[model samples]
Target chain A: MKTIGKDRFGKIIDKSYFPLLVVFALVTLIPVYILVKISISEPVDVLTQHPTFLIHNFTLEHWEKVLTSGRLWPAFTKSFVVATLTAIFAIFIATPASYVISRLPKKVKYIVILTLFFTRMFPNVGIALPISVKFIRWNLMDTYTGLVLAHLIEQLPFITWILVGTFEVIPVDLEKSAMIDGASRIRSLISIVIPIATPGIAVASLFVWLNSWNEFTYALYLSLSENTLPLQVYYYVNRGGFFQTATYATILTIPVALITYALQRYLKSDYLGGAIK
Target chain B: MKKFFQKYHLEILLILPLTLYIMYFTLLPVLTTINLGFINADTNVFSLENYEYLFGRDDFRKAFSNTVIISILGLIMQLTVGLILALILKKTFKGKGFFRALILTPMGVPTIVSGVALLYIFDTQGYLNELIYRVTEGLKYIGIIASSYKFIPIDWASGGIRTLFMIVFADMWKVTPIVTLLLLAGLESISLQVYEASQIDGASKWQTFKNITLPLLKPSITMTVIIRAVDLFRIFELPMILAGKNTPVIATFAFEEYRLYNNPNISGAAATILLVIIMIFVSLYLKYIDKGEGLA
Candidate 1:
């Protein structure tokens, strides 16, 4: 083997690589760091000539306003409830649909999967207008049920495809053998298959929850007076002050970041791999 | 009869719930929109007036072009930035996890938060302009680069390409992590043995990457691009928050027609056109990816 300083594999042993890494880490992180800083800093501190990157008189005034704004609690509660219900219903419906697709003939299976993907291409903002009009006529407007229904429609195909990836990996013979041993199909599915697919279920549930929580268009329409957190955030963006908006935005970000950090492991796993391939 | 049920029973039972929901909600609404688009309200008769009106509108033309431009720009930036981050993260080094976490955290930052945060930065009194003012003042001391003109701080929401660039950057900042993760997964799946063999044969790292990794990563890259493209086409919130609901994206254009104009028929026509365009692009991408898969 030729001894050269540049031939290092796996590890970036070169001295220049460290600078690159440092610059990247800073570049990638500094904007968000600035965001959090502005949220906590006093307005005067933020708007000053030097614009203190270093927090001096760190105040919770903006956060306090966001919290006591009276609109925050109702919107948060409504969003939390709707997102939770959407996640559950989406996964519940998607499980069986995915299983059916997983067992389809190979050629037909690919086509069906493509169709599912195609459904995702259109914008919710586009379809939501007519749908909202119909919803009003059907007396489904401004209700959690209406919002959840719309969210379910958006999330079901995605969750189902994810579960399809999970289901496909599971050996058919494991469930088949159980059925042969006198455990019924439903029993085998409930006891054996689902337990094995817990990781995928989590991914699907979180994805659905996050999508519904962050979704703007459908909520914009279906919820006439009842605002979701995203809608409330948009309201603040339009009319609220910089600090107040930052505070609410930061509030919106915390749980999502926590869930993402917690779920980072399974996120890199085969569930997404199944859909992309 | 029993045998037929036995063969198809589980499949039927499983798909039933999803089938019912799709029938009731997705199909029903889509057909409703199509129906709404085709009917004329003024005459109480069927006509293509809504579609013709939509096609003739200046806003529709601007919105269509804006969507296309933003999607293309966003796609190129996201793919390049994502690949660089992915490649850097692929190396084994101390503090790798910390760096990855720092870099990847943006993917979890809510979309509106990213949008709103950038808006703060780009505000007249926000940190972005403040930083520029300070930097330019610092440079003014050197008396070199500051001789041309006085540095005027920018307002990012001034309604131009600058606003588009800022919004695109915000999107890339939040989404590059996702693309990185996807590409990193693809890179990890590559066999180390191939790299080792190439190294032993006296191939350079650049050569190995070009010859081996590039070909192998084609499928993942294509998949990622197609997925991102489809997503970028329908972007709404970023523009909405940054530019106050008037970025002229087709989706938002459709929205304003309904909400501001109270013209659901015209909105329906715009949406239908969007759906058709997306469907065309989706099929083309699917075909291209499938062909790439076949070749590989």
Candidate 2:
């Protein structure tokens, strides 16, 4: 380690990097801190000509208002349900397809992977309009099925891409051995391959869920009557006062923060970096 | 036929559902959007009226330019900031993991939430103005300037180039972490022996990074550019939430046209234009990825 450090740039970097890192860290954190501060601060503190860096008057009135206002829970439940279903369906759909793709010949696999990349890059609003129009025709508007299906358009390719990488890393010999033991291919996949690929599957599902939860465009189109948490937060930001918007935004962020913290260890760059290699 | 069925039946069955779903849901909608873009909304006949109408509008033209300009500007900022941060974290240092995790917190925050948080930070009476006001006030007390000078807050949300800068800054804050992570992965893949070799050849730090690190990090940079370009081109929520309807990007323009103006054809036209731009990036990305060793 010492030799590695001494190889090129040692002393200048060692002395200077710490302060730079601190500045970067503060730049990332201060906005989040202000969000929480405003959520708890009195209106007088937030809407003033000279807002304090720290909370000047801490109060729970905004949170209390948001909670009892009967708006948060519906959107909360709708978002949670939609996100959970999107994750489940995305995993179910993507895992099998990815497993198959992973086993394909090199040329075929490359083409399939490219197709997935293409689909993944399609602008959400472009597709969202057509999907919304179709959903309305099918009488699926403002329904869970509609939003979940819409969310899956993006999540499917993304999750499949991640899971294909996951499935690739698992040795094919493990499945072949199970097949020799009289296990059917499907049974082997269920009992052997999936258990081994649990971590990757977990990562894929985590991302799908997070994407669905944070999704705005599809929800904006399909979810007309009942709002998702993100849509609700957007509404508040547009119409509500600073305190209320802060409270809603803070509420929306808590679950995301907790999930990311718990799963941060699983966030290998391999999931994204695998594409170039 | 029986043997082929027996050999590949499970694979076929496993892959069928997703293929079908994507065909109906994903492919169909994209085709529908393109088709709608080319059709007359009222007469239901094939026409270029929608595109013609969109092209004639000042707001649509502005949205088009804004999307292109902002996406490029934001990607540059994200890449530069991301690379700097990635380099800082590439070394072994005290509290490195803590700082890495800390920086990623913004990425985990929902995009809408980030927009709202940025609004609070950049608003007229927001934290940024307050900080500036205090700094200038202290300078005034030291007789560096006239005491009559008042600190007036700039309306960052108001539509202009300044608002565009706010959008880019907010996007950089929220997105640079992912870029950092991707570049860090690229950095990790570089062998330390390369640096050691360069040092023995008497290369300076800047030279080593310029020649060695930069060249080696190309694939990752390419990957980052593709992802950031695609995502930034469709930047919807931040600009909408920050600048309102006055400063429309292509995505917001489409949304406003559909929802506010009740013109799906025009909206589809704008969206199709965005799709065309994004597809250019996608193809470039695919070509780059194709040049690599095939995925396992």
Candidate 3:
């Protein structure tokens, strides 16, 4: 009869708990384990059932195939460059704007913030072709800059909301005291506000990087002959080489997995866009 | 004006550049889409012809219905499984941190990569059937089975409603964790004091959950449902990677219309419909997030 009470993990009511753990493990781990095993397994082993999930023979052949595929490095470079640039710009440009919006009067603030949320949520995937045509007219299509601009449309608005939440939590007194001590507004922002807001900024940056890195629909529209990491993975899978496809999938996944795990501490358990009070 | 600039100069410098960038990329594109959806390119006349053409097509009708069906099904699984998992996770347990990370690992993986991963599993001659075939063979080899028992493998990608279902499953695998994490935060925001007060009054677990947890979780519930529903509606890569371009879900349908058919009006019209559908969910989502109330 004990209710869920807050203790950080939140609550534990019953003395006996076995079933939920099993379900959790199966749902969370099984598919990933299968994917990893397939990626490293030999091509024959992948298609056959005998040595599945446990490697009888480990081979770097599939890894070699992906490494030498010629498309892989370019794809990797494209994704990394686009994603890193997107993260840097989103954090630098959006965070200050977010702080300003957060400082506004409540009615104007809600309107502005809500407008940001709507823009962030709605368009990135849906507006691909219309925007692609626009990019093409600018002769921006299929270029790295084109992809970045397309992705910024997707990345900036969402992280702006996230950073706004981040900035709102830094108290006015901290920055005010810095200003009162004759620090200029910009100096106070750099010296006082940014340092305190580091954690939220990091989480927001991780989000922007991951979103830009993994995004597909915009990359599909914006680029044609050249592929980003995600689109290249799709191309390989489309061509039907199981182990090679899995190898690329693994490569695509590793950084994201590392980033999520390393930055795990900062991810607040709310709406991802900081869609909360 | 100079005084005002002096007062808010920092905010202005901060906000202005990014605002212009957003206007160029997002706002301008949005206007162009609305424009393209209505106007004929050659005639330069705005009309409902694109929408009319879209609604008249059989494939568009199919895509619309399929989008509706998949969204509803995916939404149900996400909310139910998410709530249950969040409840399990809210409790303290052994290896809790590890388990939390494991559940959320999918969030970090590129959605396209997840599509590839699941395709490797679900393909006709893929690991799934191989596993099924070998399991029965192993039983036969061990002599624990009668000779009469047989197993046949499923051809999952044979292109039907089942293929659509497979895409839905793939999406659920990738996305359900997000919903769980959202609800977990909502549960975390509920105070220990409330539960303790209820306990003092001797409410049973089910009664307390119904009275306290459910009502308290409404905003999170609404937020998760709308977010996940719109996300599911806009699904592209899962079907594209798993089922190929022929599968006519709304997103891919729009893609096929533009890329394969080379018809901008039809694609624009389809994209506009998707925009309307998403806005409905966005409006609902804004209502809940705006309440900014108990659910965090």
Candidate 4:
């Protein structure tokens, strides 16, 4: 019986999980491959055929067209600027607020959490009408600052709630230890709590960044002049002519796909506490 | 007073900006909605004329029905499919990790992209029809789906309410993985010992699932449903893109009133109604959550 138990444990450890994992791994790679192939393959080839496992020929014509067409750079800049600014804003706004929530009395904490959940649940469209009207009145429409503010409607609660989870995971003992050492609350938060919660911070920043970057609904309606990369890609997909538009779209997806892939690790993990487990 | 000043100063500082932002953005918007619901745009005086106007309109009633039908259908599709996929993927299987990542791909694609992609696949000359045609032709000899040869090529994009189904399907394709992931998280917390004990008691598969799994999963199921319902309720881009401005989800309808008609008040009225509904649902969901924790 002991030998059987030991053997079972050994089998659990030594069984070739990698071979089992390969099929699923291929499934993930298939879409990435299709997108890349579509981006590089000849327009004729793209139009005449469906996506296959392998490509017959490659062309850099699409990349050339995308670069020379001149919308790519501005769109890229818009997306980057929006994402970076939104991340910074969300993190800065959320950190202190979440910290306060963490320190509040239990009843207050529950109320605040509930409030956050409810407000976050408020569809962007609900406030979107009134908010956009206000933006237009204030001449904030079609601006980066305007888009950033609009994003906050969604980003604020997400960042705060996520950070709250991170803050909660850290025991009070750590903060008390810092207080005993004569460190100020702010000092402890900055020096000890923040460092320890770096992964959580990364997770929060990642969510904010991806959300702002990939967001289409507000960006579509709000930004009239400096269209974000997603807007440009979408415009091409819907409005631009066959080959040129497809090529532009294919070019557009590369950065987003990369960013998404990079952040897949955090996404895979249960970073937010509200997730079922 | 000095001690109070010292102790609460940080709290005041921390909360003030957030409060101000929320007040100006969230609270004010909701209030604006309520205020708008009370007054007519032309009169600029306080009245229930806007509400009466909304309540009286035939299209408004249709829109409400459509929205509810779509939301409920979308929720049911998402939950049922999501739960099944979650269960299927929970057990470790060959290539499970990679398939898991593949399943999550839809989430990474933006909503607008999803709208366009589904449009591409399901349009008349699209891949779906082509596949169906080929399959039907091949299957006719096998006596499967007897009207296989007579199958009409359905143009999904132009199919009014049917397009809503496509929109729901597209959304499900994107969000079901999220639901599955959430339920999978719930599943993770349920120890294998429970299942083992159920098995030892000679419980059948269905019985074990009903008895052991469903009860334990109620909280997570509730969370997923409530969150996803709220998410679907405020849906704008998917239906908007697929069905155009004609598709009247609450959010899109609000957008039209504010943007196209230049009638913020009407938009506000609609939004106010939506806001109250969502808040009520959210409060109930939270109450349940609290109760589950014995906190209420």
> Which candidate leads in TM-score?
2
The sequence of per-residue lDDT tens digits that candidate 4 reaches over residues B1-296 is 99997979988798777777877888787677688778878888998888788878766666666677778899898888677667767777666776777777766666565655565555565556666776787788677767535656777777467777878877776676678787887777789999888767666556666788887877677778777878887887777766664557777777777778877888888877777777776667667653554223
Q: Write the per-residue lDDT of candidate 2 for residues A1-277, one digit (tens) a residue.
A: 5455564565676678889889989989999999999999888887778888877788999999999999999999999999999999998888999999999998899898878877877778888998888888999888888889889998898899888888988999999999999998889999999999998898789878988999898999887778888888888777857888888899888888888888887666756434734
Provide the overall lDDT of each model, using Cα atoms, as 2-decimal numbers. Answer: 0.79, 0.86, 0.79, 0.72
Model 1 spans with C-alpha error above 4 angstroms: A1-16, A48-50, A269-274, B1-6, B44-46, B147-149, B285-296
Pitting candidate 1 against candidate 4, the one with the higher TM-score is 1
Report the lDDT tens digits of candidate 3 across residue range B188-289.
989999999987886767777889999888877876776787688888888889887546788898888787778777777788888898887666655655
The 10-residue segment of model 4 chain A with minimum total lDDT is A268-277
Candidate 2 residue lDDT tens string, B117-140: 999899998888888899889989
Evaluate residue A128 in candidate 4 and report its C-alpha lDDT on the 0 to 100 scale. 72
Per-residue CA lDDT of model 3 for A1-277, tens digit only, reads 3333432222344643446657766766666777778877776676654446577677888788778978799889999999999899888788889889878987888888767766765545456777877778999877888888788887888888887777777899998999999998889988998899898888888888998999899998888888898888888777877777788888989999888878776666543635655
Per-model DockQ against the true two-chain complex? 0.52, 0.59, 0.44, 0.30
Interface quality of candidate 3 as DockQ: 0.44
Candidate 3 clashes between residue pairs 3 or more apart in a chain or in different chains: A11-B91
Q: Model 1's CAPRI class? A: medium
lDDT of 4 by residue, A1-277 (tens): 4443445433553354444444434433443445456567775555643423356777887778788878788888888898899899888888888888877887888888878776777767666766776888889888889889988877887788778778887988998899999999889888988899888888788778878887877786686677887777666665634444445545555556676667776664244324422
Q: Is candidate 1 or candidate 2 better by lDDT?
A: 2
- What is candidate 3's local distance difference test score? 0.79
